[model samples]
Each structure stands twice: as C-alpha cells, then as structure tokens.
Target chain A: MLQTEQEFIRILRSRLEGTLPEEELNDIVSDYAEHFRIGKADGRSEEELFCSLGSPDDVAREIRATHLVKKAEDVKSCKNIFHAMLATLGLGLFNLVFVLIPFILLVVLLLVVFLFGIVFAIAGPAAFIYSVLQILGIPAFAIWQSPVAGVFFSIGITTFGLLLVIGDYYLARFFYRIGIRYLKWNISVITGTEDEA
Target chain B: MNIQFKKGVLEICVLSVLARKDCYGYELVGEISKRIDISEGTIYPLLHRLKDVGYVTTYLQESAGGPSRKYYRLTEAGRKEEHEQKEEWMRFAASVNALLEGKNDAAD
Candidate 1:
C-alpha cells in the first residue's frame, strides 16, 4: 500500500464515517488535509509525513472514544454510558482492571443498597400495620415488646430506609459525574498508540 | 520517554502553546512534536475535544500563496485550564522526583 496524503485521509474518513456526525467528519478530515498540504509545502515527502502522523486507525479509535464519552456525559443514560465504557475499553487491556472492575463494583454496590432500602421500607410499613391490628385486639403477630414501641420503631425504620434510598440516588449521580470525567482523562492520557490494544 | 507518558502531557502542551498564540493545525502539531516524540495525528482529535468543551475556538486565515488555514485560539477557559493542569503536573512531577531520589531508590 502506498503511503500518500490521500491514503492517510481516506483511512481516517472510512474508519470514522459512521461514528462521527457529518459536520464533525468534515472538520476532522480538513485538519489532516491541511497538515498534509502544509507539510508538503514545507518540502516534506508524503511517506515522511505519514510516518510521523502514525496510524490513522489509532487516531480514529481515540476520536470515537472521546466522542462517545462526551455523548454519555451529555445525555446521562445507561445505554450511552455503556457504549462509552465499551469504546474506552478498546483503547487498552489495562482498562479491564482500571475501568471495568470499578464500574462493575459501583453498579453492584448501588444495586445492593437500593434493594436493602426497598426491603426495609416495605417491611417497616407492614410492621406498622401489624402493630395497629394488635392494638385493635385483632390478634396480629407481635414484632416488638409493646405495640406503641413497635409503631415508633417502624416509623423510624421507614424514614431511615427512605433516607438510604435517596442517599444512594445522590451517590450514584455523583459517581456518574466523576466517572465521566475520569473516562475523558483516561482517553486523553492512556490511549494514543499506533498499536490498538 | 514512554509513549503513554508522552500522550499524557500532550493536552497540556497543546493548551500551553495556544495560550501563548494562535496556531494552525500543522503549526501546533509541529510545535509539540518538535520537543516530545509523539504521533502527530492524535493532536487533531485533542483539538476537537478541546473545542467541543468550549476551551478553544478556530478560524480561517489566508496564507501567502496558499488556501486559507484554520487557526486555533484558546478561550479564557482554556487559559485557566492550562494554568491549572500545568501546576498540577508540576507538583506531581516534583513529588515523583523526590520519591525516586529517596535513599531506598533501587535503580541507579
């Protein structure tokens, strides 16, 4: 294959066409076109310029990862964030430990907290109902030494559960925001290479 | 001299250079690669990312005997980012250097 200006731009365009928006595609293409044009004018050969530019495919991967990560940040959806993580994972195998492990752990942590919150919230209400029934002489199951104490305890439990749920939500949001920033930093720092990992 | 190490600093280098003066795409890449050996193609994507975040903006300017060239100028935010990243990097490097030169340093 000939290492020429046109060839470099072609590879870049072909790799990025479907992923990047049309306007973005044109802007990126033009940057490299200008590079080749100016380099040639400066008396550099096509091969020399191409060599210095490294692999267009690698460049496209970085661009795609950057774009997806930005999209995920803007939209704030599961699908978007998942796509962004997948794209970043392509940058290198090291991210399997760095990005993927932490992401999975966080997801699991949030889910367990949410489940516990819901269970406590529902159980608290049910316990309160039993206490009321017992007070009315309906022979309900006893969960506490006194029906009055049970009512108070159940109310406290319900409030605590609700707070846990709400706190978990805010925690998830905070982590999501920080996670997006970390992925952006990861792409910029760890993934500029000719060999795709 | 590792490639990953070079890639990490490229963003700050580009922003620091632009904070001084506007540069065309080729000119900016040339300025950076002159000092740090890196794949020049990656700079364009980095520039686009900076632009997307409103840290930088671009314009076209006519050159002698050539088509108008696209020039990148740093925004006020870009300057702030450059200053912050430069300071953070300097502090990080200093700490790492201090650790490396400590008495337990294994490699000479």
Candidate 2:
C-alpha cells in the first residue's frame, strides 16, 4: 500500500521473488498504491515508498534465506548456478577431508586394533567359550561343530567387514575430492576466471 | 557477513523461508532481521535471483485496511530445493563434527 498498483506490481516483481503470479502482482500493486495515496500527494513518485520501505536487496536476502532454491533458480543461468553448486560440493569436500576422512580412518584403525587385540589377549578364552557352547548345544547356528573353521570364519568376517568399510570410506573421500575439483574447474571455465589469471 | 559467504549461502536460506508461507516485502525484512545481521537492502537482489530461477510464485492480494500487497510463495521445485539444501547442510555439518572431536585420539 505504498505506491500505485502498477508501481507496486513492478516493485513486487522486481524487488520480491519474480515468480509471483500476475494477478497477485496486481493486488500487491493496488495495495501499495492505496498506501501511497493515503500517505502523500498524487505528484509523489513510488520511489519514495521504495526508499522508505528499505533496500529491495535486503528484502530479497531475507526471502532468499527461506526460499533459497526458488531464488537460485531465477538467477541468471550461467552466472550463479556454477557457484551455487560449487558452494555445496566445496563445503562437502572440505568436511570430507578435514573432518570425515581422518575420523573414519581412525575408527577403522581402532576397530582393527581392538578386534586383533581381543584375538591375542582374550581370544583363547573366547575360543574356549565357543567350544563349550557347542558342547552345550545352544543351537545349530551357534554350534559350528568345526572349531578351526568357525574361528577362521569369524576372523575372516571381522577382517573383511573392517577392510570393506575402510575401503568404502576412503573411496568416497577420493571420489568427492575429484568431483569437487571437477566442479570448481567447470565453474572457472564458464566464469572465465582464468582471464583474471 | 562476508560478501562471498553471504552471497553463496543466503540464496538457499531465502528460498527455504518462502517454501513455508507467503510473505510480503516488509514482513520479510522483519523476519530476517531477527536472525542474521544483514543489510536490509540486499534482499532485493536475492528476490530477483529467485524470480529468474522460477522456483517461487508470487501474487498480489488486497488488504482490507490498506493497499494490495505482494505476497511470495514457493513453487513445487522450490519446496523440493528447501528439503534438499537442508539435508545437505545437516549431512555436511555432521560429517564435519565427525572429523573434529570424533577422531581417534588414542590411535596414535
């Protein structure tokens, strides 16, 4: 209600997210027109309302914070898209290298050490318990019947699982790094940042 | 806010907000001011970007007491984007946390 209906529509379309329907824009325009009419003389321009209302960019920022994807979509195609994609992917990579990778490796190492340590330290006892359980006939599943086969299989499963997890974790990190680097390269290529070089 | 950082992340935040409800220009100013210390003028540019992408839909409504007001709402794509961005943020943040204190300090 700060300017004429037409002026309000233009401002809303330009100042707010542009995706609003035309009819809705008309309504906004009328509201502002009425508000401006009540506030001042007919000779005054809608710019006054714009100024008093505050920076349109500021409003966009607030709106964007809430509706980032919509706002991002309308941005000039070649201009911001690369950057936006770079943003998420870059940050994700940052997390992977500085945070995720080392942490995962550490966990893997600990797990391996713990599992092997148990084998060396308390494993004898654990194996004794396994045979005892078989004698007690806990279940077909529990009674491996073959001590060597069961022990080897248990070791194999634990080691294989640990290796597999560690391998997958490292692979992910490598792929993420490559992906982000590729994306950054694409952004630079499209934006012509190399010219600055 | 760092201009670079703000420019990158702010767009995501705005779209996410519109995904929830339709808001007017001034109402947006009031809401955003509550959280981050941003120049009120910057929001205008952000809105422009959203329009370009076609993620948000806007319409004007008549006010009983005042002039018509422009109200912004999210399109289908806009809603999906909000969820995606949020998911990414949470996962990224969690991954970051895992790196810091979650590391095996005892491994060495």
Best by lDDT: 1
Give the top-scoring candidate (TM-score): 1
Superposed Cα deviation of residue A134, candidate 2 (Å): 97
lDDT of 1 by residue, A1-197 (tens): 78899999899999888888999899999999999999999999999999999888788888999999999988998899888998888888788998999999999999999988998899899989999988888887767769998899889889888988999999999988999999998998877453531
How does each model score on TM-score?
0.86, 0.38
lDDT of 2: 0.52
lDDT of 1 at A193: 53
What tens-digit string does per-residue lDDT give for candidate 2 at B41-98? Answer: 4454456446646777678888667667677788888888888988998787777776
Cα lDDT for residue A70, candidate 2: 34
TM-score of chain A of 1: 0.87
**lDDT against the true structure, each candidate:** 0.89, 0.52
Give the per-residue Cα lDDT of candidate 2 at A129: 61
Could you tell me which residue pairs clash in candidate 1?
none
Candidate 2 chain A, which ten residues in sequence have the lowest lDDT sum? A188-197
Question: Could you tell me the lDDT of residue B23 within candidate 2?
Answer: 82
